[model samples]
Target: MVRGAPSGDLSGKTVLVVGANVGIGLEASKHFARMQPARLIIACRSEAKGKVALAEIERETGYNGCEPWIVDLANFASVIAFADKFKREGGDLHILVMNAAIALPVYQPTIDGWETILQVNYLATSLLSLLLIPQLVAAGRKSTVPSRMVIVSSGVLYWLTPAKEIETSLKPLETLGSEEWCIPNHMQSRYSESKLLNLFFVRALTDRLRSVTPLSTIAVTPGFCYSQLRRVWYEKPTFSFVKIVLAIHERLLAWTAEQGSRQLIFAAVGGRDDEENMKGGFVSRGRLVEVADFVLSDEGHRMQDTVWNETIDILSGVSDKISPIVRDYLVVPDSSIN
Candidate 1:
């Protein structure tokens, strides 16, 4: 089991967890409540599930700061509405955890044109992060404690290989999102690709925030936890035999939900003194670790830049609600791109 307790206090802070209904997310929410935050907002796709989680958190932790808010990551509009409501009613946002993600064995497109995994895990996650930046900046400026954005990524990203299609183009992001690249046969790769993008986004955003905001952005791997995310494979008919094997493996090797959540809790509250160094860094097993060698290569640097620019461009087209400061930070100058 993972070990370590959350350091410092969150007595009057406001915390938000995007996927708080199950697994590590639910466990993390309970941990946050125990820290005595002023408010703990549980944001998830289903109101019913969120209510159940809210009650469970309160009952387990005996902390009443927990509340449920519905936010669907598959729909950009839903993300916008959730952000808008929080801006209107929420207090200073101290901790923002982007932990909601979906991995599917079958190919499915979201209401947005992108594949389901891509939409929920990367695009919509980006939208919510961008929309909420102003509030994070404000909170950072006024609070003595540093505000943070913890992105839950996966160690699976280490397995990603450069796609042949990506290598053939000067602009890789255009082809990377194509349907041929995101179908079922390639679903595992697609999920790994999304986690890679999460790392890229964290690095880029951390650089942007360093000068203008006190918000520290970092990526973390929970080290192979047992979670509902495995349902994608277990629920498939063709994978029944594989499922049984995996179940046994998980029982033997995977961290419990509570154990898995300790990493995220540590990232949120334990490493305050190292916030500057932690910015844009990756954490695994409670220690800062180097990203994959490919991610540090010249080609990888170019892809990261391309992905960041493409993400901002796509999000800008979808929502005109972005504040000017956020727009300024995200928009790549025409000269720089050219």
Candidate 2:
């Protein structure tokens, strides 16, 4: 049985939840608020929506120190601006949850001219994490407390083709503007690629942070939650019955947002000092499951390395000091699958 985390006693800890306007993000913010964190940074695209969420959370949880900040991950300029503003005004961030993602409607280019889904899900998340690493590092150095960076990845990374094929498929999207080249219909490549990118990116960050002392980076999938994002797929009138059936299924198999946030909370502040059990991998239902067996294979690690290099190159362009921690550890891929 999963023991309740040693009380919601975050007290002086400062936690930041990206994409905190709705769904899992909102629930996570509220959960952190209940812990009475020193500060809760609600990063979202809509200031209005974020404010509404913040107010509701404060009211429901009787917790304070919640603030909303605008950030559009699809745009690079906005991500940099948000990070700079946070660096100037926002205090030390002890925990940063990379929870924002986008499943593109069709193939589109972001402001940086990269694929929209990839830009938001991978590139944008990387930039934000890189920009904020100094804060986490500084906090670790100054307070002698552990800090964490958690990326909310997906289980689909293991569901797709072999890692070897991924490398072969990784190439330039010649028709960035063409709907014909869009994903989902074409074997759901876009979504799968973005999820896979998340795994590799987090693994890379984990490796880079090992020697930084007291700081940790972990990646995990939330499992198939019954989120509004899922409802977006059942918009058609004919899918009503199917939606109902799926909704029931989701209710049975998927946990609520609060339940979904448990592992994230655990990753943030659940384990004890002596409990070195839940370090890395995909986690869910308060348990760490092995990712698909192949995910641990050489090809999988190489895939992670490939994406790690690409992510580092992208972030390096933004900040020269940004580096991925490469280390040897008992790192697991999907903690929720096994």
Candidate 3:
């Protein structure tokens, strides 16, 4: 089991955990409630699921202050509406845990005209994280302390390599979302590739946060827990072989959801240096670790810039607030100046 998180009193802090309706997200939200936050917002896609999560946290932790809010990562409009609602009425937020993600074995498109996994796991997640920066900054300034954005990534990123099609394409995001790349062969690695993009976003965002001292972000891997991430594989008959292999792997190495949530708790409410080191760092198990070896290669650096640029350009089209958020709150890397 992972060690416990360093104790911190969150009597006046506002903690929001997106995708907290189940699994690691639900476990993490329950842990945060024990810290006695001023307001613990449980962000979920469905109102019923959110209410159930809130009730569970209250019953388990005896913290009745948790609020259920619908924040659907599959829809860009829903994400933007939540962020805007918070901006208008919500107070400063201290810890934002972005733990919502999906794993689909087929090419499923959201109503927004993008692949389901691509939008939920990358594009919409990126939009919400960037959009909420101003609120995070306000909380940090108010307390004269730092705020954290703990984005749940995965260790599987290190095992996968980007397709030649993606690596060679000038427009990586477009190429990724193209129907040509969503075939069976490519779908096998869709979730892994999305995790890779998460790291790249962290790398780029960490660089941008250099200009904003009040906020720090880190991407964390829960290290293969028994979670609902593989629900698609179970529900889809075509993935039977894949499911058998995963069940074996999971029974052999997967941690309990509570055990995995420990890493997120530590990242969200760890010691001073722990939080300070969150500047785009990667966490796995219970400690900070280096990113993938591929991520350190020259090709990796170039690809990081490409993913960052493509994502930002797309998000700028999604919401006009993105470009200004980059300009006013973040410093663009020198390589992206053009």
Return the top candidate by TM-score.
Answer: 3
Residue 203 in model 3: shift from native, Å? 1.2
Score residue 124 of candidate 1 by CA lDDT.
90
Query: Among all windows of ten consecutive residues in candidate 3, which has the lowest summed lDDT?
Result: 329-338
Among the numbered candidates, top lDDT falls to 3
Evaluation by TM-score, superior candidate among 1 and 2 = 1
lDDT of 2 at 130: 75
Q: All candidates' TM-scores?
A: 0.93, 0.84, 0.95
Model 1 misplacement above 4 A: 167-174, 210-212, 237-241, 328-338
What ranges in model 3 sit over 4 Å off?
237-239, 274-276, 334-338
- Candidate 1 lDDT by residue in tens digits, 240-314: 776888799898999888888888887787677787778788887777889987788777777777787787778
Candidate 2 structure quality by residue, lDDT tens digits, 1-338 = 33343356777777889988887788878878888888899998987888898888988999878989899998888998988898898777788998888764456777777777777887888888878877876676766556778888777766776433345444322232234556546534676667766766665555544453566676767767766655555766675664687778887877666666666776666554632334455665555567665557676676666566666566667654454322232133332321
Using TM-score, rank the candidates from best to worst. Answer: 3, 1, 2
Kindly report which residue stretches of model 2 are placed more than 4 angstroms away from their true locations once superposed: 1-6, 162-165, 169-184, 210-212, 235-248, 274-279, 318-338
